[model samples]
Target chain A: MKKAKGSVDEFTQAYMEYYSQVFSSILTKVGNAEDARDLCQEVFLIFFDKFEKIENKRAWLYGTLRNVVYRHYAKKDPGVDIDEVFNDVGLTFTNGFRDTRIIISEALEQIECGEDERTMLDLIATHNFTYGNAAGVLGLTRRQVEYKYGQLVKRILEYLNSKGIKDIAELL
Target chain B: MNTSVEQFHQLLGRYKLSRPVSPGDQEYIINSRKQDLKDLLRKKGKYSLILWIVIAIYAGIRKFGIHITMVQSKIIAGMTAVAVVSGSSTGVYQGTKYVIKAISKPPAKVEEKIDEPDSGMTIPDRRTTEEKTKEEKKKSADIKNQDLDATPLSDVPSL
Candidate 1:
């Protein structure tokens, strides 16, 4: 029950505050609940230990989380580099999605699939997870993910096509 | 293979991730924190055990031999400490002064004082040494005469 170097609640409160985002990120990255738990714990343990001296708490946690996730992936598969897809996508459809985004969101929300496929879509389409990473998350093979994810995309496209006049290029 | 498909995939993920996490995920966050606190307490307990062990070892050392002293020795040691603290300052100062003097010895050969003839010096009293002695004796005699003259007339033998 002894407090850490600083106030006792600091680590606990920070744990409560940032754990979800960090856990979600780690889960998204490592694609395993158990590994994400362990890795997120590792990040927070470091955070707890250095809590007193750290300045930018969120930044410190995120930075440490990144390294921890990277190390986890590296240990799992030496060739896997998640950093390549870590950056946000810059596409023509993003900025002016004001009208199209509502349509897209509605269309995507209407489409339903199995929990596995839903989790897969959540990982790949929502969480910025790559096909291989999504496969790892869903416990599916990479080839299966590519095929299924492509089918899902085609379904979404067809749905969009059905809801609209042809020429998908016009939305662009 | 299509650029649009890839962009949509990424874009959808971005929007989904931006939304608030589901309530189910809160359970994970809370459980992990409980684990953190549990592990932290274990670590603190470990450190405290080590600290207590250190304290116990130090207590044992004191109780066994090293710092154990007879009352007489303790009193004597206390008196010695008091003496050193209260009485040593002047001694230290004197010792330091002498040590400084000893360290910086004066240049080996002291310059001898040369004596000169008194002829060059003017004697303010203007009397020769012999005359000075004679004048001193005469002054003492005059003092005696004055003393004799100071006797009261009543003290003279009744005529």
Candidate 2:
């Protein structure tokens, strides 16, 4: 049998060298640590799946992370200002844990009646895991985390509209 | 832009307040990555070496099975050497041909820039001219009004 050209070890090494960079790339876009970490893992899983087809695995990892983050943002209100949360939370959280916690909390409050939603949101927000990180702890997709967060926001908006609340500040 | 700069600083402050990941966290991540790469390279090299060794062993087994004499073996070895040398020389010749061809070829030509036609004047100049004309018209209108006022009712034409 022909021996494989690249091994699991090689991929792992590449992942290590580039994992932080991938996380950094995702965080820069997603603006949350747990989400960035979750995306980081997803990037590796993608690397493992497409290992044979990829030429430069490191670049592939970064590109995949970037795409996932963009997809997350796109699913949300494209007009939603990421910079607002990022700036408000402050970049001081290099891991972006606090920011992610705060954003998730804000998003969760917007969402309506699902006991599971509150439980999951509490696990992530109060405990301070990123949507991505929470997904890992909860066994979900990074996309799922983003979607849930989005749903929460939508529910909150609906609730507010029903209550005649005017702005995001009202939720606060 | 100024506000973004201020906002960036504020974000940076919040980022610092979060729980620290610690030095060990970073090291663990980095070390695991290094080990993975080293293992991959090592595995690849070992596989390549084994392949070459297996081929050599197989060739030896076939050659001895043929019951070749010393003289025939020597001749075969000499011919193999000649073939290898000739093949290399042929490769060198082809490489040299490409090099020479590349060296002799002229670089691609770049087009010279041609000046474009100017529409009589630019926007700012046109605006200034328009303003100046309006000013001149105003001044003339003012002089006509002054004349009308200065000339008495005697100078005015009868109905």
DockQ for all models, in order?
Answer: 0.04, 0.02
**Which candidate number has the best TM-score?**
1
- The local distance difference test score of model 2 is 0.50
Candidate 2 lDDT tens digits, B43-75:
445324433333233334322333222234345
TM-score, prediction 1: 0.36
Give the per-prediction TM-score of chain B.
0.19, 0.36
TM-score of each: 0.36, 0.26
Q: Where is the poorest 10-residue window by lDDT in model 1 chain A?
A: A84-93
Give the per-residue lDDT digits (tens) of candidate 1, residues B1-159: 466676565555444323323444544543455455456546645334433333233323332323322233335556756787878897898999999999899778978998885887875777789999999999999999999999767855795
Q: Which residue segments of model 2 deviate by more than 4 Å?
A: A1-6, A78-172, B1-159
Candidate 1: regions farther than 4 A off: A1-5, A85-172, B1-25, B44-159
Residue B114 displacement (Å), model 2: 99
lDDT of 1: 0.60
